[model samples]
Target: MEILHHDVRAHNVMLGINCIVQLTNFETARPQSGGKSWPLKDKDEILRWTAPEKDSSETRYTSECDVFSFGVLLWEIVSQTRPFDKIKNGREVFKKKILIGERPNINMHMKDGHQISVASDNYFKIMTEAWSQEANHRPSMSSICERLRNIFHTNINEDEIEYTENPSKENDITALDPLTQTTTSENILTSNENNVKSKEEILLEKARQYHDAKDYSNAWSIYNNLLESDKGNAEVKFMVGSYLVHGPPYCQNNDIDKAENYLREAADDGYAKAQYLYYQLLFNKAGKYLKLAANQNYTEALYDHGYHLYKGTFERRDPAKGAESLIAAHYQLHNNALGKLNELEKRYAKEKKLKKE
Candidate 1:
């Protein structure tokens, strides 16, 4: 479904917890068929932010209209002031002015009155391109995001960034964040609380890319950093622990004890996957961990926990009830578990026949 917000403007975007900007005011939002378009709507939006084509006639406005609105919104972001603030009757003036292709002037201070240093010329050029009269000429949202990323994070290598059109065939860098729009008040990431969140995102993405590229040593090195200390993310903990358990070639020669401990740490932090995987790996040896995962009804653990209950394998036995639960969970992906299920069915039938005879 192609969901249109209908309203795209500076005020519609607000900073939420963790310095993340979220879009609001979805009162006029509606879903369009994948390839179909929506007619012009939401005329009450800031007149300066409306696309020229949208204003010129009662033409069908598509996602491209939001692109035009975003171009004007970028002015609000850069100038940090309402467009045409100098003129009286600015509201009515901008509506007519935009129809003839007028747009806000890009400036220094952001809408919040905070001054920002220009990092790249492409930034302003991108802003101008978004306001291109022809909607087809405007850069796609993906392209806009990449330009914003390069500006936001200065060290971003052009080679590492993914492109929407005409992607390079050789050594393509798989994008970690796709279709996720993030906007800030220019210098917001530098603020104290948001800095930590920003660092976590950067480090997490770093580890993810290294892992995807099979740069195991570097991936593990980063994972190790995220694994240690109180600042470790639960996902990081689960990842290291799961990696240790499964030993994907990078983490081959699995460390049973370390995996259990790492996964246990995340389980303590209330991570469900960590609970289940840890339970599966250590249930026989560590019943407590099994119960921890079992409590969450983790799929594989449910089957294993029920199987153990049936056979009295490190748990209280109730063969009839447990077998029913075991078959109900029906974990077929794991070869060993599949074999056990088949064996249990055969044994159960044999015993039943013998009892009848």
Candidate 2:
């Protein structure tokens, strides 16, 4: 009765009404004693969620691999972020880092023990144990369930937990978008007790739809209107400014000066993304802003600032400070950051070897 969910990431996990947790998307699920799973070609999309051992061309993924993925999912739940989120080309970097025994920083952004619904120590143990590189060293699903039962002080049977199917037209349930943290029908940024969405919410959703549909002109118009109504909204300013910088045709796009002006305004208002974007455009002049954004734990800024500190790109070389910055970015699941750290570790190892030689 063992199941091997080839993809066990957070996006496939769903939380329904009354806090009913269900693991949907059985498209990739196979019997642990399976004959065949997904073809290797189809696995590119799930590279980040697969186990380290999946580097081989073999199609037979074991339950132990699922345990590895579950450990990653645990990291996702604790960090509330995707694995290797900011890495544009993660396959090569991910493979290299995994070969060097790198895993996500489990302690980063950990919530309070009570908030996570399990004692922090127990949760950590479970997550780390599940991630053991030796597949057999990983704990069994039953052991994990036992730990959960102990945490909750209840003898919860497998039958007691509900499993909802993936929503279909008949189900009338909208799946949550991992990026927006909202359902397709509504934005969670606003809540109305009467169940009626506010005008601003409606407009925000419309703007999002337009942007997603690549109707940049309409999206710009709506965001501009929203900005007019709420002049002090830093997020709105960032959206408007970003469109101007990188928007597609017919939306006043690629206006660097205008974009910089808007981004600078948003950056001054303490929006971390804006601060980082502003630094990008004014790299030679806005080193301070890069540091400011890095201080706020902005992932890109951390990677860039760490790179600068390490290579002295626009700052003095201080390998220690650079490593520290890269480590912070790595904790947040930045693959590029991990890549840099791996590079440093290898170099340090080589140096030590040379000294011994």
Estimate, for each residue in 1-357, the C-alpha lDDT of model 2 and write its tens digit.
777777788878999986768999888677776558855444654676666776786635888888888887888988888776766555854586554567777656545643543466787789888977777899987678657544432222334333344335344344443554355435332333345554555666767887888867666777777877777878778888888888576365577787888899999999999999988879855777888999999998998898888777777777789899999999988988988877876876787799999
Summarize candidate 1's per-residue lDDT along 48-79 as a digit string, tens digits.
57667765454766777788778777877777
Which prediction has the highest lDDT against the true structure?
A: 2
Write down the TM-score of every candidate: 0.41, 0.39
Lowest-scoring 10 consecutive residues by lDDT in candidate 2?
A: 153-162
For candidate 2, what is the TM-score? Answer: 0.39
Pairs clashing in candidate 2?
A: none
At residue 157, give the lDDT of candidate 1: 45
* Collision count for each candidate, in order: 2, 0
lDDT of each candidate versus the true structure = 0.68, 0.73
